[model samples]
Target: MASSRPKNAPFLFPTFNSSVLPDPSRFFSHDLLSAPLPTNSFFQNFTLKNGDQAEYFHPYIIKSSESSISISYPSLSHNSAFIYEAFNADITISGSDEPDQHSRKTHLISSFSDLGVTLDFPSSNLRFFLVRGSPFVTCSVSSGNSSIKISTIHAVLSFTGNSSSTKYTAKLNNNQTWLIYASSPINLVNDGGSSINCGGGFSGIIRIAVLPDSNPDFESILDRFSCCYPISGDADFTKPFALEYKWEK
Candidate 1:
């Protein structure tokens, strides 16, 4: 005879172990880029336009957690040189059991994540993550018969400490070298009561140029970020720069 179970009797089945399942959080907690070196890191100090001082660290690390991508710095109280802007993209999931659930979601993105590059300073125990956002550099390239213009962002990580040199260099992928020069005077007072100029800027005016040796057509590179950074009238790509940093003084 078949056994009859009570209406509220607990169903007996094989014990499923959730430990064997893949952890979704682990996927987000991984490092996006890392290059370990000695503890002797290189850093520079700069005064903000509002009269506040901050330190910039080179050879930094980029790590992503469940919520945001963090650019690790030596000091937690350091001020950011440039404005930090967060972007969002809409993601649609097609194959979902429920029509309302998982239909769409907004994903947060970093402006510098797409064009970020890592560089190592020779003889220094540091690796710098060079990245930037809006106020993009518009490049005018001459093709066979037409001129193509592309807007992209790049960062000036450090300067070649030459007393007589004013040009700052940034090396990108495929052996591309970018030149950065101060368009305006950068005056900052350090803690030592000395005025410093002609170094790096936490937030100052500078000009950028792409060498002819590097690839002028950044269409392929920009295509990779089409979803995150759409070229629309309201998008950051259309603006020269956005100042999100507020100073009290």
Candidate 2:
């Protein structure tokens, strides 16, 4: 499928370049690239000493930073915000068909809380994006205290075929806030499904605003960006998150 590009700045998606990307099939994964990116391309990437890597992406740009893995790209607009919340679900016990079979899913999300960044904006003209061209499913680890901490440090998408959309709601006095509805959503490669072998590695970057909300009902950006995840339910991780609001407007 062709990448449906974003507009410069519109009511819904008004904070990015409007160039349409070539068919996703035409884009090659980094594992296949044998050398540096073309001088004029829009894709950019950085790999850390410990092998941690993320990409700096424009509509047509691609890059590979093999030595600098810790740097991050800040928001480009005054009304931008960036947020990342993830939980590493580890299994303490495997489920078996036997009567005594046991299984337990423990949330490892909070254990690595210090790995994320929270940027604040004064007003609500927010635009957010998950940058790297694709989502992650498998990554080889060499840094962090142990080898299993690869995706844990970067908030890489869950490899278990789980897609989650979260809604955050709050209540406020009489006012109107449309940041959530007005913001942009980057529809990235879905579910990490193709299993293209690249040393079990993938990269992604998300963009958010830190400016003030043009509409006043929302006092702080966090109030709207915070998400609520259910502790437990007989539900698959495939949940389409709708918005939840406290109602200031």
Candidate 3:
């Protein structure tokens, strides 16, 4: 008339226990502006798993794992070219050499498990699409309403299995300025190469809307191009130009 059971036994029947899944909405399409793209700029939408969508300004999207991606539009004062940067892992480029070929194009996408960085022209605009990766540090300069500001981001995947990407804007400002997004973290230095105290950051999707500097004071700007050589074409896909970060510390 009595029944006995194991105190620590595994369940054999299907249980109603539920597990929490990651929500892409928190990180993607949270507060996007419906404002149209400016001249010489375009908007491209990407569909992630679960059918969620995110829109990016530039044509290229840098997909990576184990490392973060950085796309730079070095200021006109520094240079007139675009840069694509990645660190701590390997990646590959997808999309077309001439994305302008179509107005709204969607390539054969897959599960977000591969690592790749899409490289486009040497034009003055650069954007980054970071996949899974470790903490990456980088900075950027933005100008708004005659005010110039430099900011940094420390993007890291935390121990809680969630990602952290925070943008820290610098307090400095100017009347008219040039916006520069470094392909890598920049170390500010004096004339003698002594390091300055500019803060550090991590590489993440650059969401700042960047416009080409209409005016530049070339003389006052520090020279970071002595180590980089120019590529002839408008960034030929077969022979894409590379700009190594001169101030890696």
Q: Using lDDT as the measure, which candidate wins?
A: 1
Query: What would the per-residue lDDT of candidate 1 be over residues 182-244, giving only the tens digit for each residue?
Result: 322332222221112222322222333444354546533432332232111212344467633
Stretches of candidate 3 above 4 Å error?
Answer: 1-20, 31-139, 143-187, 190-196, 199-249
Provide the lDDT at 126 for model 3.
24
Error of 1 at 83 (Å): 34
For candidate 1, the lDDT comes to 0.27
* TM-score preference between candidates 1 and 3, better one: 1
Query: What TM-score, computed on C-alpha atoms, does each candidate reach?
Result: 0.19, 0.18, 0.18
Q: Compared with the true structure, what per-residue lDDT tens digits does model 2 show for residues 1-249?
A: 854666663334344432553222122333434433232222212112221223343211211111111222222433346554222111111111121123111111110011111111111111112232211111112222111111111222322211331111111121211111111122222224311111321122222221233344443543344332111112233547743222110
Ranking by lDDT: 1, 3, 2
Error of 3 at 36 (Å): 19
